[model samples]
Target: MNFSQIAQLLVLGMAPLGAGSYALCRAKARPERFGGAKFHSPSWYYGWYGFLWAFLPPLLLAVASWILRLAGLRPAPDWVLMALAMGLGLAGLVYAHRSVNPELRARNSVEGVIHWTLRMSSVLSILITVGIVSSVLFEALQFFSQVSLWEFLTGTSWSPGTAFLGAAGRETEGVAKPLFGSVPLFAGTFLITAISLLVAVPIGLFAAIFLSEYASLPMRRIFKPALEILAGIPSVVYGFFAAITVSPWVVNTAQALGVRADYTNALSPGLVMGVMIIPFVSSLSDDVLNAVPMSMREGSYALGATTSETIRRVLLPAALPGIVAAVLLAFSRAVGETMIVVMAAGLRPNLTWNPLEGVTTVTVRIVDALVGDQAFDSLETLSAFGLGLVLLVFTLILNVISAYIIRRFRQKYE
Candidate 1:
């Protein structure tokens, strides 16, 4: 149904709820009614109970109708469904109003509804994740059927420009076969991620240490929020900054030093992406360091240890798991980043060790494959899913390692 129709249905459902709440409130105040028994719940709970009774039926109806439509079935007209929903809501409201008695435990009923709502929300989230993985896996399987997994993983070249012609059965006999080697993409991705971590980890860790251990209260308050503002800035904005500002500076500085650098060098985007993710590391590491016990610091002082020594030996070790987790999380963020890499790092899948050279990441290649007018079943188009699946696996492995580190070594300080 349209927004207006949905709003009208919700209004019809909720009007009785407000009425029921106030009515029960007034009724409960009159103790002589129902032989002076105390209410099983507060009036607000009764109101919510009535609200759910009125709302759920119509919501279910709409969902069922929508599902049926998706399955290619003819459903009732919107107005007819809206009318049916209104009738169900009114009937529910009447039932709720009549059922309101001192013996009815509306609080329990309302809480049960809330519990189920939360459970359903969790289920929906899990289902969505499973659906996404399954769909990508299926498509990636199709891609691998055409291109061998060995070549895709170990090949050094990634020229897929003419793969479409092969898929369309029009490949010229003299043409070289399209190579799907993903090694360069993976290398570029890791190269950028390593550069970003190099810039982010030291700066972010030091900032966190200063905030958690050294900075004054006022300084910490001002700086922490200011630092976190970096996280709030959009990736596209960082991409723009990298492209317009950092890339040119890198090229010019390289030329001044008699070293050549591409305008789309990996360093520019890496630096920008590092700056963008500094808050992720800093914020998380700060919280973790702060969580280290005051008792540990006191013990260190009692042992005649200096502040720096205490932090290095005691707090850092204690919070190492959290710090590692934060670093890994940042690694995942850096690996998955697209906009900055796309804008600053050129789309050439170069297998090179030099950060000054332009290179493409998996995410950039995925975007390239899916963006233009290409056949849906083409090897080039399906390669996006293959890249996505590999990326997904990489992320999952990182998460598993992070979990293991946290679970195995995390210290519980009182």
Candidate 2:
């Protein structure tokens, strides 16, 4: 294989080997550690320790090397660098393992590294969000400086054609509004999201209920995974399905009903997006629902409540906060969805409510504005950042509210 392929394989191999070595070390450190024996540390802790030693150094080296390359510095050959890094990393692991006491210093040190790793993962997510927000803010600030914020927001016209074509010094015939009037985009997003939730929520909830409350062990094993298969299909495939098959059918059906429908309207994409989000809503909701104490269920049943009634009144209420969190998370997913909307929803930004007619969403516009080659500072290009900022804010607010509610719910239960 080529260098890239070889690098990939080496990295992949390192992860499992590191994991296995850590597991071995943990097993060795634990005393009779079986049922009735004292152990040096928990088995899982040792596994994580091994994972740290095996994965962290090489990963860091690779990342640092890539950054250096980006900064225009040529590094040593990949094979030589990889070999030296791995050798040094392994030597460090060995030294730490032997020098640190398994019961005292090593355990805490390993645990500290693992904890730091976990915290780093969370920080990585937050940093990514901040980076996205910063990019949007910077670009939107540029766009706003060029075009008045009032005209951008309130003017009833939107044709980004001038921004793309660089039609400079033309006489002003009328106010040239941005093609980014969020009303139609937001409306389209909500309509599509509503449709998706409508499609996904009931089916997912029922599926979860069946899995958690009614299914036999064998059936649970079979169906839970089968349902999850929906989540695994690449979104591009869903987009294609919606574009080629579903859009035509929707147009035809709308025509039969005496409604004017674009071949690529909101309904097909919304419906497909709903299908895509089903597993997310259902899986999370089911897990939250299942987390409700069995004692609560039994107490309700003892009071003469039937299974369904108990589920509705007791279990559902108990799990309501988590369920809401799940739904909100799904809503965020729907809002941020790009491919399905891009492929299935018409690009025309019509400020109409007729779901049968064509409509566009913020994500659709962002894609349209940013995809082709154009002046980077143009309103059309920068409008993407503005749209992204709005979307980011909306989703961030939802996430915050969901997190607060869930945290409060947990405190109440505790």
Candidate 3:
């Protein structure tokens, strides 16, 4: 059979083997005299052992088959090899289970292997993260090689089109700076984030306070998960709402204030993003606020401090570090957001301070540049990497600083 077919058979083979292994392991652990030693684990542990034996060997063999293909040693379809490997592994496990004594220490040895397998699974996730970071770094390095570090960093103009033309062509007209500067993008990110925070923080914090400090247990049970429902709403829905409904309302509201406003401006998206993040901020803030020593709040209240005073002065200060961390986390989420900005914010990269005007963000540009099929070597494509790297560095710095602040605050409290 073809490779894919074999692969499918292998996957199908694994299911029965895994179930059979578990059954065999449980049977082996039954109180029956067989081979010499006594089983050290419970029936379930043996079952887990059987599953590990059935799954791990075939997985390893499939990996080996892939490597062989990469090395031009394709002998049989990968699926066939995988199925064969799994069948063999299952046979070995069954033989071992039937022959081994229920009271034997073999179960312990199998359990050990199962534990190692579980730990190894985590490497898949870590390796994927490392792969992404490595790719971004490599592409960013390539971009820097073509564009001088100073021009890319310090130059107010960010027109990457000049980088597309070779030195021969650039000698006549010089590099035409991209009309879209990153500052506006950065500013737009901050403006939207700031507005979102303004909208979310107070509402989220108050909700958190009500839930944690004032709400009845029944009310908390009902409200907490309801608040989390906000987070569960798909971001794309938020984008559509901002783009279709919120933008027009914002424009009309600005007109009422005797100011012109673009329909697709930063305000609408920022407001929607704020609504999205409120649950995040509230949930985290609530946890932090609740973590404050009850005695502290009681002491303030006993001293005749009102609820608001105690919340503002005692609970808030106590929770400041965690709240700051939460805010920074929310800010990072906002900054990295793409859909809301892409759908609601206009694509025109104007270096304007006015949130009422049409402006673009770094994330929007990154999407625009990389969305369609294009040659990877082109400047337009490479510019996405450059912008991504800058964004990565910015977020990393903020995270580091926020972590430092949180740690220092913890130390003070301790």
TM-scores for candidates 1 onward, in order: 0.93, 0.78, 0.86
Candidate ranking (TM-score, best to worst):
1, 3, 2
Task: Report the C-alpha lDDT of model 1 over 83-170, residue by residue, as the tens digit.
Answer: 8987887777777777778888888988998899899999999999999999999999999999999998899999988878866778
Model 1 pairs in collision: none
lDDT of 2 by residue, 1-414 (tens): 234634773566566667666766665555554445554566556655656776667766777777777787857777776786677567646754553234544567676876897999999999998887787898888887777767656644557776754434445457564454556677777888888888888888888888889999999889888888999999999999999999999988878988878877888988898888888878988898889888888889899999999989888878888788778877878887888887888777777667777777788788887886777767788888877777777777877878888777662453
Clashing pairs in 2: 22-50, 196-274
Reference-based lDDT, each prediction: 0.87, 0.76, 0.77
Q: Which portions of model 1 miss their true places by more than 4 Å?
A: 2-8, 11-32, 169-171
TM-score of 2: 0.78
Q: Residue-pair clashes per candidate, as listed?
A: 0, 2, 10
| Arranged by lDDT, best first | 1, 3, 2
lDDT of model number 2: 0.76
Which numbered prediction scores highest in TM-score against the true structure? 1
Error of 3 at 178 (Å): 4.8
